[model samples]
Target: MSTDKEDLVVDDDFPITEEDVEPRIEPAKTNLSKRRTIDNLLEERRLQRQLADFDYDL
Candidate 1:
């Protein structure tokens, strides 16, 4: 039993080819803008709720 590094055998067909992989797709700009708008609205509502729940008495 030899523990040499070069003892392993690599197959030529084992490497991945360009055709076998799928291209990465990015989200549309409109969708991202809409998400940002929704996020801002939600944050504003949260802040308003926090302000309403605060006690003003010393």
Candidate 2:
């Protein structure tokens, strides 16, 4: 048995896409160590933004 191309798609120029590229993302972030890592990264980003804002205001 073989599959047909026309049965699969409406247009070649544009194709439908899914909301999630990763199958299971929430489970990966649920770990305690992973959450802590994310928190630290966010704090560093916030500190950098504050410094940049202060420099522009002067």
Candidate 3:
């Protein structure tokens, strides 16, 4: 669902042009593209294994 809001008004002589409306902008990415270190990958794998372990109380 989009959270953007736009107003719709009915006008006979309304001059519609591209300059009147704001340009659609893409969200900027915060993280830069960089090669991952070996230690970082190993920690990620450890976390994934931890989450995969399931314990039932039944």
Candidate 4:
């Protein structure tokens, strides 16, 4: 379906501030590759658990 341009918002009710941004940390150059691989493996495991009907009750 075609949408009207008026449906989009142009105003920024609550503008983002500098404090809202988290401080960046510089990672060790040698550790960067290993860190990314580990992160990817962890994400894969989490997704597999979800697909297998695993649940973490509150």
**Top TM-score model:** 1
- Output the number of the lDDT-best candidate: 1
Q: Using lDDT as the measure, name the better of candidate 1 and candidate 3.
A: 1
lDDT of candidate 2 over 1-58, digit per residue (tens) = 5665565555657655785355565665478778899999999999999887785644
Q: Model 1: per-residue lDDT, tens digit, 1-58?
A: 8677676676777868898899866678877998999999999999999999989996
lDDT of every predicted structure (CA atoms): 0.88, 0.76, 0.70, 0.83
Error of 3 at 15 (Å): 81
In model 3, the worst 10-residue window by lDDT is: 27-36
Q: How well does candidate 1 score on lDDT at residue 33?
A: 91
Better of 2 and 4 by lDDT: 4
Error of 2 at 7 (Å): 38
RMSD of 2: 11.9
TM-score of each: 0.51, 0.43, 0.32, 0.42
Better of 1 and 4 by lDDT: 1
| Candidate ranking (lDDT, best to worst) | 1, 4, 2, 3
Cα shift from native, residue 23, model 3 (Å): 53
In model 4, where do residues sit more than 4 Å from their true spots?
1-27, 54-58
- As a whole number from 0 to 100, the lDDT of residue 28 in candidate 1 is 89
Worst 10 residues of 4 by lDDT: 1-10
